[model samples]
Target: MAWIMLLVAGLFEVVWAYSMKQSAGFTRLLPTLVTIVGMVISFVLLSAAMRSIPLGTAYTIWTGIGAVGAFLVGVAVLGEQVNTMRVIAAVLIVSGLVLMKLSAE
Candidate 1:
């Protein structure tokens, strides 16, 4: 249950990040609201998850999800350039997360 909450929190991190981008420096009202709400929920879930998961591990996975999800969304929706090195870095982040999760189990 805690792990599931962590996963959902990680996904909320992604939504918050994406909404931040869309918020246009907080100039856009709707996106700004979404960003605020998402961030709050994300943190709430993260705190809950931390009751079971180690702080360092949970934090890294949360940020990793946000980073990778933001990068992909930027490329797909915001016309950001896709580069080999960027993709490789994202892959490495994911690999590290997987390794940590496996080791935890």
Candidate 2:
């Protein structure tokens, strides 16, 4: 359950990140609102998950998910570059996430 919350929190992190970009430096209204709301929800869930998961593990996973998720979103939605180096970096981040999860168990 804590893990589920954490995953959801991570996803929400992605939501807020994307919306934040869409917000255009907080100039846009709707996307700005979405960013704020998503940030609140994401923080709440992350706090809840932290009650059970260790702080280090929870934070690392949360950030890792957000980083990778945002990277993918950038590539897919924003049409950002997807070079070999970037791909390798993402893979390394994912590998680290897996290792972190394994260590926590």
On TM-score, the candidate that comes out on top is: 2
CA lDDT, every model vs. true structure: 0.90, 0.98
Q: Give candidate 2 misplaced runs (Cα > 4 Å).
A: none
Per residue, candidate 2 scores C-alpha lDDT tens digits across 1-95 of: 99999999999999999999999999999999999999999999999999999999999999999999999999999999999999999999999
For candidate 2, the lDDT comes to 0.98
TM-score of each: 0.94, 0.99
Q: Which window of 10 residues has the lowest lDDT sum in candidate 2?
A: 96-105
What lDDT tens digits, residue by residue, belong to model 1 across residues 17-87?
99988899999999999999999999999999999999888888888888888888889988999989999
